[model samples]
Target chain A: MKNKAALIFGYNDYALEIAKNIQDEYSHIYIFSLHSEEDILKNKSDFEIKSFDLSDKWDYISENIDLENSIAFSVLEDIAENIFLTISLRSSFETLNIIALSNNKETADKLLMAGANKVIPLVQTTAEMISEMMEKPIVKEVFHKILFESGELKISQVKINSSNSYLGKTLSEIDWKVKYGVIVLALVLEDMNSEFIYSSKIKNHIISEGDIFIIVGYETDIIEFEKIIGSRINVHWSHWSR
Target chain B: MGFFSRLIVNLAYFINTSDAYQRKKRFFYDILENNRYPYKKYFDIFMMTLIFLSVAILIAEVKSEVDENIEFFNTYVISIIFFIEYILRFWISSSVTELIINRSEHAAMLGRKFSLWRAILKIIKVKLNFVFSIRAIIDLLAVLPFFHELRLLRLFVLFRVFKLFRYTTSFQTFVSVLSTKKFEFLILLMFSSIVISVSSVLIYVMEANNPNSPINTMFEAIYWSIVTISTVGYGDITPYTSEGRVVAMFVITAGIAVLAFTTSIVVSALTEKLDEIREIKTIDDIRKLKSFYLICGYENVAQEVAQKLKDSPIGIIVLDEDSKRIENAKKDGLVALNYDPGNMRSYKKIGIDLSTQVKAVLCLRESDVENVYTTLTIRSINKDVNIISLLMDDGNRKKLNFAGVNEILYPKGLVGIISKELIGRPVAFEVIHALRNDYYGVNIEEILVDNRMIENTMYVSELNNSRYRVILLGIYKKNKNRFFFNPLDSTILESGDYLLVIGNSVFIKEFEKYLHKKIRT
Candidate 1:
């Protein structure tokens, strides 16, 4: 069998960005174009480049490409072609994961109907990224980690059980990094409501059973800290240690 | 016909597995499910007209001046039509029995053989299910005009108007929106009852014996109290004694307080519920969605994101504790929830977990600490969902990341980049700004090579030399994760390559047209 690859259809900036982000996850990355084959060939990119028509039959694709192990990106700028490509690919290959890029919700719905497994709206991500970069505050306290701190630190949360010794203790009272080898970030109440320990609403909130504490530490320290507070929540990001 | 052959036809018809049956099912769906077609719309208009005419005749008959026989005849005509419509709805639709029978894994095990008794049993089961359904119950209640001679039974004719709600999309949406806030309305009602009753008893004790008092008994006092609290002041009752006057004054002030509080609560709840209704029309709509970004706290960052997404085709639901913020978001044409974002009940109320389509949850609260808490709570609820959290405090990044936030958006770091980019490269900044702002008609577009062109190899300069009006800015090779900018003309064409092209609006349209023709051919 040919090596598993990510088939990104579209010769565009968004497709390029997507390829950049997910390249590490696949063995081979193939860029397919529908609009301009000459433009693609002129670009001296290190990876393989190819062109294809939206009307290409499944038999033709299956003969040329390994559909079983390939994931496809249908980021063609034309919403109709994107949807058509998604539908054709989906009908042709039942398990090929198809990700399509949509310009808006209506097209996104159409693409979804066309059988794209995932549709990422381009403008929204750009808006989100630009807003993130332009509007954030730059106080030292807020920028301390990104600016001053660097380490292989991991964050996790532990629920405070009724049996824990630090039930009523405040943040100042606990030498968290020394005693528990973890830094308490915030507290989540039993009602599933959460607040930063230093925030006005929770500055003096006495620790109680069922309150989850967001903490940060090394992998071993987090394990040790989990023993004291209660069972550690296997946070989705806890795999960074692995 | 043999029982087996009849059963096969009946099963094929009822199960609607055949193409003809599927078409019939689509017809039923178009008419019965929603007012989407001209036929259904006209049908709704016809039914509404008949309902109003019947209502008018009933009112005229109640006045004792109209001919009772004519009114009775008209009522019968209306009821008969409604009855027919209801039966037609049942016949064309899939009965509950057919659904269960077809869905069951035991269908094959039972073999192709069918019996008369089994068909009867299926009909009986479906009838029971249909009778119990709210739609059928409404239909039955609305068609009770046969008992028009009974005065008490005639009162049920009012329920026929409610059937009109089913035909009107706006009316159904309004009712469902109210039902969503049923608990709040119920609480307000309960509170109003207590206040009126207790105040009535107190006033009855204070003024029942006063010679000048209009209020005499507990019932009269209760009526007076309700009128006072509601600010209706029908002017039928008055307090005479000094104690009674003081009690009345206190009750009046309390009435204002209650009205203000309850009205505010109901108005806000109704607004939020209506927005929710607009978000999801049917379960199928939610099921069809691949995934949506859930934003908690519609603060500045969240608003910015929502504004940008409004023009895009991404599904987003914004949750905020402030009704005003939610109202603002709705004004901006966004699906926003004005409930506690951290509440699991609220999440379920909006159908968040229906399918794993919740792609990411952005905890955009201004507080880094709160963001962390939100990240943790969301993680606990759905471990697989990606969480992108705003880091207000840099110190909270580790905590947020540890709390299972897949991505941490450092707003502060972004500001730093903007300042550097602005000062270091102003010209490049303007180009970036133009693209971001879509200045002029110039835009950057990404085009993917169609599989039909997989065998063809064309160089970049050749395309630039041709009728292609777009400028090929760059090329990205997928396997190597390489982006070749301002590429050489000798680059070989391959399948699945991405070309970043730039062109004006007209040229882009031309290029797209050219591409469509090329790909289709």
Candidate 2:
């Protein structure tokens, strides 16, 4: 079978971001716009580019691209244009997956009526969320895992017991990464002072009985690590009934 | 077959086929399932009015000089409606269960089909259960006047008012709220009862022999105690003795204490229920959204994003760990939840599921680590959802990359580059500015030169003609890895070439139309 292609129908930050995100999934990516500038053209790579308007009949699109397996992204910056693009694409290619961008609910509904398979609304808070997310390391890790990785890893916190053999020992002596296949993410000492495991302070600081280790690894490995230490409680995705 | 068996089978068949029974069943469901069916508003109004009239008649019947005919109409006519309504309700409840059992194989049990007689018996049992239910008892109470004329029976008419509970959501919510705090209410009731009974007995003992005392008998003493404790002293009965007066004073103080305590409990419970109703409404609103963005965290950046989202029609739900932050977000007119952000239950509570309308999850926690964890938890619950994360530090990029962040926004880095462009290159800055703002007529856009445009390479200059006058700024030749700026009219174009153009919005749309012209045979 031929490779599935992605057709992005606008030139904007959102279109560029979407093209980059789904680049791995599609074999070929084609970005279309009426005009372009240096900012959009910067860092351009393997994807094909086209100058075309979707308002007209898709004669150029139909003859050139494989509509059957390809997904069309209608990421026009203008809501009206985006809806028109979606309607144009959907009417031309009945079975083609058309993803459109809408700014609001009314536009989204209009795009839906125009036969868009999916409507990804560029909510205003997205930029704010992006900036805030970068500051939170765990959130970044979770975001990466969900977006790019298999996400089979779990984060668990285990408290050291006085009876444990490794008590009072430095984290370097544990060889957690090699032996247990777990990555120690952070630690909270007996005094409730916390720091990332990789921080310079935790490198030489001896682990005490009441010390808590926040580790990330496969579920089984985490469980095994917990067995060696004391019992473990998951730091993330724990049971929250309320 | 025996006579009894044949009769039973025939009766079952008649029950199944009777149109009146079916209509009554429909009517019962129409009234009972008011939330689901159409025209329920009218049915509800009629039933509510009937209840109001029934209670009114009951109040009127207590009068000493009421018209005989009107009294007869009240007792007999209204009683008939209540009787019929009771029977219809009983039949509908049983039939609904039977219908469900008949339709669902699991309900009837696997590999065992119900025999006709067994099914009838099962239905009859269910019917009997419905007939004896509290609601049914209330229905029966409303019609008791037709069946029995016991002087005390008239009092049961007051219970007829309880039937109003079924017709209104507020009444149902009140019942639920009361039941939830039933233990507290029960304790209050017990304490009140003990105080009233003991105080009444003591007052009776003290005041019975005093000629100035109005509480002469045990019943009157009980009434006096109740009135005093309720703080509604009718003054028909009073204690003249010093001990009895002290008891009366204690009863009034206790009544106030009990009233305050009970009122506080009920007021708190009702407020909690109201909050629950609001949450339910939010859930319903979330359900109506086609696709929405879930912003996790409410820091400065997240708030900025939420502010921008105000212009979009897309729904947004903000999740944060701090209740105060959630309250603030709510005040800002966003649906916000203060929950364990990494918990799957939290997502589920907000209706985030595998195929929910959650188009994207943006992890915006102030800590990069928390964002990564949130992304992982959200991914675990909804694998295919799009996730955007902010990259705080370059070091955590690899980890976040592996964690599956689709879009990593480094706002600081972007700002740094844009700042450089603004300072060094004025024209480039203006172009970028034009691209960002729609107010300017001239904007930059890119177009791909595909198979259709390959043959038109000879007319590259004509492409810039007045009909669709779009300035061709440059051509990105992927094959040669070179850019051709200010290309001559003779410059040939090929498939997979990118052409950057500058044009007004009108000219650009026109240019796009020109590029998409159908090939004539």
Candidate 3:
């Protein structure tokens, strides 16, 4: 496995939060501050802070990190700057994964068009939706366990290869929940269209090589499911997330 | 106390304290005075129809000899209803027994002799006050036609038109506007009366004795003065003398001034009441709603919630003190009101029947303190209304919880968590977001297992996920008050259980239809 690194562009609360959360997941975390010298000095944090301007080249980034194994977050508070940063990173490093934060729908669309792998719209709509869904006590409990209280539950995607035993079997032929203690949420087809596992159109559809199954379970249970199914955990497509 | 007096006091107390008596009085009060009562509209419609029908019959009788049956229906049925309504109004206007009981209780509390005579006089005073009120007088006159023997009382039937004022809210608002401008109207009346009286005397003195003039008497002169002052200009009684013409000129000018003054007064009063009337209409519309979500502020969170719920079956009403925000919300095609969300009276003013009509309340104010206050106000109004508030600051989370907020949403924290998840498990986070946002028509829905399903003895295995095209995430057993996640295939489904499923929304609807169809078969 290649060593993973994170290059977070923009030094703000959201950047700080992402850095802090993913600190242990990656071997190195770098926060690129776009502000002036005084402002960067004022923003003292545990992560390594480096100053960068919008017009700068990626010489320092390329020298310091492996571009192919790194993830870059374009989370500048300014929407225009964030889009520009995403474009610049994508133009500089073709293989680096780029994620951007947006405040509204228009900016989100723009960020995606500007070469971001994924755009997280930091709008209140998602919050309201979560609040509405939390009205159900069951949902609240499940989400609380998954996002806050318990860290054991993991959602992982596994892609079937040619040698997998379940490659030619239909979804209905397997009782994954009873046999493996994991719930398969959806399946990504060869064309990248995702379908719910229980969808009637895909009920009898045979799983084959390159088919990705999105599943959720405890970490141990997921790994066991992956082992028994003869597949490896991987994200097949960058845009397949949504 | 004397024995007779004690008997009277005991009787009054019994009547005042009896549940049956109080209930009957309350029923009448609800029908007559409580506009919020659901049945009041029906009562109002019935009374309006009766009044119109009786008036129509009265007009028909003047043109031709009406059929005896129709005449009897009009004379007896309509008048009897009016009479009963008047009696009910009078009975509910003030409680005589309560006044008596209260007076005697007060005297006893004061350690003084209870004067029966004074109490009787006080009761009469209160009753007389109601009887002499304009509404009561109108009610009395409307029922006067019941005395068929007195032909003169038939003219009083016209007063029934005034009774319509009590039934319609618009008329009540007009009356309120007029009442609010009482001082202005009084001044206008005084000014016009002085002008008319002085002009009438001047014309009478100047033109009554002129032989060639058409005004031959003081009465004619006074009539001319009134015609000129009203600007009617009948031309039948024009002043022929120059002095009389001069007086008429002054009266006409004063008449225009009085007309302008009256118009200004009424216009200003109506303008002042326009907002209140509009609010009343909005409240009436809200009262008619079967279920609605009350968003306490028209901020971003509220705007998003309202937009998302716009296509839903439930109604949405946004309230904020900032008129600009309300206007923006209105432009977004939502029912918005410029009302202070923190004020307890706003709930009452908006007619939020939380126990019945209000499905939930979202306190999404920008200020944490305001959200807490709104939650407290809503909880104070009704304890069972589901309240969700956005926590503007982390420090206010406990405050919001203590204020009885059902759910507290921290948007920044939620964003932080999502950002973190995106870094660690990007695909999973995106999948959840897509499900929540209903991306590509996929979403989560809850379907209730009703009595039909229970009667059919359905099992979890019977609801095949592949067949239904939906994944059963869990079963919320209402009886157990617990959710059974990933239940076994043989788990028997029961009534009141909510099935939480995830799938394409269209497929979910079809699956629900199939469930219903299966039960029917």
Candidate 4:
């Protein structure tokens, strides 16, 4: 069933973000922006988008008038442009849900007066971020990915079970692949990543409760094995596997 | 029970073990372990074999239990125990420590470890530790003066069950091997169990009616079969008939080989898995510290950079993989952990993630490549962080430069530039030595500013007074990456401009006084 959708007009990257988050839920979405074709083409992310200039609404509507399936919401930073786009989309598609971003209280009141279904003010969000950045530079990176420029390897968590032959032994004696074709990156326990990578051949580095191994494998293998790897592996804590 | 009493006993035992006069003491004293020699392992096994043979001989040699040959029996039994303990000890104790320390052929002959006589001496020597331990007293009772008067004590010799611990290393190795080979060895163990069960049934079927048949039932037969296979060969029981004897012989040889094979494999497996001690990698070995530091990654320049930083009392974190460098660091008592700071976790190990505590992080890893990475990770965490790094290869300068490091130390390129001056004189070397040692390490220190200065004041002298007692070395004009090493003295110290000074507590106090004056006004 195709559900009624909203056209996210212009909240910069957040427009695409909203569309992506609810794209599968809603049947359709349309994003309009001033971003150039070159900028859009340069991005490698896999998001489906179709763009058209707001001033050329007549030609856009005449060519592709699919307003029956969607709504229009302008997230443009400028007040005059957002109001013009909202009024234009409403005049043509009266039943469509209209939303727009506002820079201030007066702008939000203006957007609402122009027949927007709702108006979200963006100044408060920027004001909070401004305060944060001014205070802490260290916390900013913590909120982003830590890139190891030269190191090619990445670490992730995996669990152990009887299907793996190295249940009772340590890392030094296990034949990592001969027994199971998984290169243990590191053991991730509750608090820290352990020093040893227990291969199939290690005899003394015994697998214990809550021991998660960081394993590296081919992407396809990892995907196929995720059902067995990531989920809780129910192992009976006993002397031998039943 | 008392502390001094325990100490006294322990010391006395130590002196006994360490004494010069004691012959066969090393083996008997067993100072290396639980006070027993491993040669006793082979001896016990031999004695068990003899016991098995003696039981067989008693049944085979005498058809009647009531015998007129008590003297012959006594001589034979006494000789067996005597030959096993004394002769074997004497025989085994070759090149023994008692002999070596005494530096005489006679003492060495007695002290030779393998000799049964030497073993006897060792046994007596061990009795010394029993002076305090209850277990030791019981052990002495089982072997000695009590045994002479009481035949029960002689029988207590069978309490030699304690000899089992004597082979702990081998046993531990075997257990480890079994544990590692848990999956593979399980199959063989199952097969061995079947074989043992089958042999017991077969013996019970064949020898049910024969007198003197040790196979009284399936259980006894199975037990005997296991004992024989494991080479325990206790002489308490033996097969009577010729048919049973034939089966026993085959089982004995096969059992010996299988047990030996299992033991050897386990020992080899255990030894292989024994040690996997992880050594700290360079740079990661450095522990976290709060601010103001220098790190010289390579050995060549490390000495100079470390010396200079040491003079300033700043926390210096050095990381190098070379053992020689690590050993040298150990002598210095600086916070260090061996690891590649270029690697992801290693950087975190040195607490790059906690860069707030560290005022500036120096990328002094092995080469320019690592330095570039160190700079990148450090900067990615703290965008405004002060970073100074080395570049051995000129080609790597662009990469390190892009990483936002404050300064790059290019050894070869800088040397080429320095060669331009003092061609004949050693003034360059002296300058290099002093700079490396004490020439006020740069690219560090806080920039204090008067927040209340007039917006248009351009010259530094307007802000200069005893209240701002420090000299204005430089100003970090906001939004610019360039630094003036020694700023023009007349340059403006605006409200936003930072006054750089070589820090001292007194100078900093006076400078803060300027800030107090600004607030008062």
Best by DockQ: 3
List the candidate 2 regions with Cα displacement exceeding 4 Å: A1-242, B1-43, B56-133, B143-157, B270-274, B284-293, B313-315, B339-363, B366-521
Model 3 — interface RMS deviation? Answer: 2.9
lDDT of 4 by residue, B456-489 (tens): 3446555553233343334556436333333444
In order, candidate lDDTs are 0.65, 0.67, 0.78, 0.50
Error of 2 at A192 (Å): 56
Sort candidate 1 into its docking category: incorrect
Candidate 1's DockQ is 0.03
Model 4 segments beyond 4 Å from truth? Answer: A1-242, B1-181, B187-195, B198-209, B242-367, B378-388, B431-521
**B45-159: candidate 1 lDDT, tens digit per residue:** 8888888877787787765776767775666878898888788677755554455455332444665444445656676777778778998888888888767777787876777
Instruction: Kindly indicate the candidate among 2 and 3 with the higher DockQ.
Output: 3
The order of the candidates by TM-score, greatest first, is 3, 2, 1, 4
Top candidate when judged by TM-score against the true structure: 3
Give the lDDT of residue B229 in candidate 4: 77
> Once model 1 is optimally superposed onto the true structure by TM-score, how far is the C-alpha of residue B36 displaced, in angstroms?
15
lDDT of 1 by residue, A53-78 (tens): 87755553576566655667787767
List, residue by residue over B1-521, the lDDT tens digit for candidate 2: 35764455556557767888877777768876646465776777787787777677777766756687767776787778778878767656756443434633442466554454665566677778887899888888878866537878877666677878877766776788878888889999999999999998999999998888887899998999888888888897878989998998899999998989889999988887887777766776776678777888887567767775665666788888888888889989899877767888886676655356876777877578988888888777766878887776656878777888787776434432332222222222232333333335554456777887665544465564334545454566769866554455666777877776555667777777677673433
Query: For every model in order, what is the number of clashing pairs?
Result: 42, 58, 0, 50
Worst 10 residues of 2 chain A by lDDT: A233-242
Q: Please state what fraction of the native interface contacts candidate 1 reproduces.
A: 0.07
Query: What does the interface RMSD come to for each candidate?
Result: 20.8, 21.4, 2.9, 26.5
